[model samples]
Target: MGYDIMKNNNTKRLAVSLLLIFPLLVFGQKRVEAKADRLFQKRAYALAADEYEDLLKHNWNTAYAHKQLAFCYFETREFDKALPHLQEVLGNDDLPLRYIWEYALLLKAEGKIEESEKWLAYSKMIKLKNPLIPRLSQDSTWHPVALLERQEYKVEPVSFNSKYSDFGARIYNDTLYFTSSRKTPENNSNYSWYDEPYLDLYYIPLSSLDQTPKALEGGIRSKYHESSPTFFKDYKGKNSVFFTRNNLKSGQYVVGKKRINNLKIYKGEQKKNGTWDMSRDLAINSPDYSNAHPF
Candidate 1:
C-alpha cells in the first residue's frame, strides 16, 4: 500500500510540473515573437522571418506567427510565399492593420485586382491606423499599392537638412513642421560613430498658389534634438506644436509634448517672462517602447 501511494504521489507531482512548464513555454514563445517583431523593425526581414517560422513550428501563436512571416516575405518581395499567410491573417476577425497594404499589394501582383481594391478600400475605411501606411505610400515602390487613382498627389518636394532620417510631416495654418538631424555642438557631436547629425525640428511657411515653403521664425532653430515634429490644429482653438526628442533619456525613447526651447516634449505655454510653465510629460509614450516614427 505504501509503495502504491508513493507512486501515485510521484505521478501527481509530474503532472503539476508539466502544467507549470506549459505556461513558461508559452511565455518563451511570446518573447520570441517580440524579438522577431524588433528584427522586422530593424529591417532584418530574413532573420525575422526565420524567428517567426520557428515560433510557428512549435504551434504557438499561429495567427501572429503567420502574420509576421507574411510581412517578412512581403518585405523581401517573396510574394508567392506570402499569400497563404496573408490569407490566414485576413480570414481572422481580428486582422491587424499592419499588413493590409502589403496584402493588397500582393493581391494586385497576383492579378487579383478587384480583391486588392477591396482590401485597399477596407484599409482606407479604417483610416489605415497601422501608422506604416503613410510611410509605405510615400515610397515610390509601394505607391501603386495605395490604389489611389491620382497620378499626382499635389505634393511638392519640400527640402530640409538632407541628412535627417525618418522625417515626419504635418500641415498646420498652411505651414509644415518637420524634423532634421543636421549638426549641433551638444547632441550633434554624439553622432561620432554614425555620420548623421542629431535631429531637430524645423518649419517652413507655405505659399498660396504653388504651395512653396519658406523657413518660419526667420529660420529659427530649436536648441534641442527634435525629430518627428508635428503641429496639431484640432477642431477646437488649441493650436500647438509637438516634437520627439531622442536625447531625452540616453537617445533611444521619445516623448511628445508642447515645444519648449529644449527637445523634451512637455505641456506648457510661454509666460510673460518668456519662460515655459505648466509643463507635463506625454502620457501615451512608454519608456521601454520608444515611439519612433509617429503618425
Candidate 2:
C-alpha cells in the first residue's frame, strides 16, 4: 500500500511538470509564428522561410504554416524546398489556383511527368479559384510551341551558364547574347524579390565559344534587370539593339499600380565606339504594365 502511494505521487509530480511547461511551449510557438507572419507581410520572404522552417522542424505542423512556408520558398525561388510544404497544403479546400499550378509545374520540373499531369487534370476537375489561368496558359502556348516539331536544329546548352537564372537568349551577327543573374564581385545589386543579383546582359562571340562570356561592353548594365537583347537597324539605318529593362523614373525604382516594377523595351543606338546611348524606353511602353521582347 505504501509503495502504491509513492507511485501515484510520482505520477502526480510528472503531470504537474507537464502542466507547468505546456503554456511555455504554446507561447514559444505563438511567438515564432507571429514573427514569421510579420516578416511575410513585409515581403521578407527569406527571413519568413527561416522562421516557418524552424516552427516546422519543431513539429508544429499546421496547414496555414505549411502553406505560408510554401509561399515563402516559392517567392525566394527555392522550389525544391517548397515542394514538401506545398504537398502538405494540397488538401486545403481554400487553396489558390496559383499554388496548384505551381505544384504541377514543380512536379514537371523535377521530372515527375505523370504526377504533374495528374495534378493538372485534378486542377481541372476542382472548383478552380482562378479559372482564367487555364485559358491564359493555353492561349499563351500556341504560338511558342506550334513549330517545335518543325524545327530540326539540335538544341545545345551554352557553355557559360552559371548555377543561376540564365535565359532569354538570342543570336545576332555571330554573337550570342543572353540574360543571366550570375554573381560577380563588382555587381552587388540584387533583385528585390530574392537574394540573387539582378539580371544583366552577357554575350559570347560564336567564334570564341570556348572563352568566358563577357558583359555587354557599355554602361548598359543597370541596377535592375537588363534582358532580351535583339540586334536590328533603326529608322535612320543605324545599327541598334533593343533590350528589356525595368521602368525607372528619375533614376529611382518605380512601382506600378500593381506595386510591381514592370519591364519595358529600351532602344540603344550603337555608337561608333560600340558603347550605347542613354535609355530610351520605347513609346509602346506604359508604366501601368509590362512591355518586352522586341524582335
What TM-score number comes out for model 1?
A: 0.40
Shift in Å, residue 206, candidate 1: 46
Name the lDDT value of residue 191 in candidate 2. Answer: 54
Residue 221, candidate 2: Cα error in Å is 2.2
Residue 226 error, candidate 1, Å: 28
| lDDT tens digits by residue: candidate 2, 17-84 | 99999999999999999998887876778878888888888877577789998898878878888899
List pairs with backbone clashes in candidate 1. Answer: 181-198, 181-199, 267-280
What lDDT score belongs to each candidate, Candidate 1 first? 0.60, 0.78
